[model samples]
Target: MAKILVLYYSSYGHVEQLANAVAEGARAGGASVVDIKRVPETVPEQVAKNAHFKLEQSAPVATVADLEQYHAIVVGTPTRYGRMSSQMAAFLDQTGGLWARGAFNGKVGAAFTSTATQHGGQEQTLFSVIANLLHFGMIIVGLPYSHAGQMSVTEIVGGSPYGASTIAAGDGSRQPTEIDLAGARHQGELVAKTAVRLFG
Candidate 1:
């Protein structure tokens, strides 16, 4: 049974939704196990007391041991100022010990993200996640242009040649479009299949 870790940092729920879609795709492609982990919030003390702000639901904190048990890892994040959120970055930074030990060497890696606007730096966020995988010597996988949604014309709202994505409306209440969901699933399946081929 191959296990894939779906790890992410999401604010306003968009990225979490994308992560779920990615996991669904991985499962559809016959991955035996999928674990979803969320990075913890890190708001300043002054802002923590604000009524408008609330602590994000924290997923299980991933340890170096956790990385060792997985055949592949799929990372997701919301776009933050043309980059991945600092929480996600901090999570990756904690993996320095794993990198030093070559714990992820040759393992499969993939990324996904969501943005508040159509042009809100989804690609940059994906690449930012990919960069950390590279440091760990993990092979990066991405959604191919061959996916059906990629060729469709009905407003491709999410996913890309880089990885999975979603475009939340300005108000942040809009769910991902069906096309976006399909693309995310495709990305998950592709990464799972690649991991199986490479490591199984």
Candidate 2:
């Protein structure tokens, strides 16, 4: 059994759903504990007036200290110019001490994201998150080809070998599809299983 944390920052609720799906997958993967958390929003309320950001998210705001407690971490964020959201970036930026101290060394790490378009920097943003996890000395985990959802062709959705992702419309109208959630769950299972095998 392992403790897995699903942490993310979602602007329009899509990533929130993705986070839940990932957590569910972790639980199903035989983790002893699974927690879902969110990064504090950096955008000023006034600027996000029409952004449709979910105001009632229930996930607790995550802290750098929490990362030290989890056996594996699965993080998600919305795309910001082929990168992770500034909010998530800000939270991760505060972990410099943890990085230097090897606090997350050997822990499993994975990432997922949502974008406005099918090709809207999904892989780039996923890898950007992965780069930071690598610096923390964490072992990277990804949704391997074993998950058949990675090869979806019936619809334009989000899921890659890098991680799980979803296609949100430009107007933030689209939600994650079945395939997207399935992929997210797969990533969670992989991370949780890996964590348990290594740490337990």
Candidate 3:
């Protein structure tokens, strides 16, 4: 069995919901332990309190050192100007030691994200995260084309071969749909199964 880590930084609640779905899928895929963690919030307290959504959900903060304990890691973030949120980017920026030591060389890595609009840089944000994972020499496990939901033409869903995602709407009024969560779950399962095969 493989130990998988699903770490993310969600401001409003969309990414958090998707993160849970992803974690559940990872466990369903036979990972022995699925630890869901969050990168610390860096915004001002007052600013965060006035956000359009609540931070009702949270998880333990993740440290770079913890990466060594998991065979697979799934990262999630909300898009910021067609890129990953500053919080997630900052968290990942601290992995110099891990990178220096090749701590994640053989681990499976994947990413998921949420954007404020349909074209709010979803692919770019996911690719940015994947780029960092590659810097650590980790094996990239993307959402495969076999996930039929990724090709849905009728529904407004979020996901691609790069990873999973959801549209959050510009005003933060939108929440993740079942289709979005399903895509996230599928990505998690794929990464988990890959981890079991390669690292278990």
lDDT to native, each model: 0.82, 0.90, 0.88
Model 2, range 66-99, lDDT digits (tens) per residue?
8888989898999999999999999999999888
- Ranking the candidates on lDDT from highest down gives 2, 3, 1
Query: Of models 1 and 3, which has the larger TM-score?
Result: 3
Q: Which is the winner by lDDT between candidate 1 and candidate 3?
A: 3
Model 3 lDDT tens row, 19-133? 9999989988989899999988888778888774455576888887887888899999999998899999888998898788888998899999999888889999999999999
Model with the higher TM-score, candidate 2 or 3:
2
What TM-score, to 2 decimals, does candidate 3 have?
Answer: 0.96
Residue 169 of model 2: what lDDT?
Answer: 92
Clashes of each: 0, 0, 0
Model 1's lDDT to the true fold? 0.82
Tens-digit per-residue lDDT, 40-70, candidate 1: 6776746755633335554665655677789
Please tell me which predicted candidate would have the highest TM-score against the true structure. Answer: 2
Which candidate number would show the highest lDDT if scored against the true structure? Answer: 2
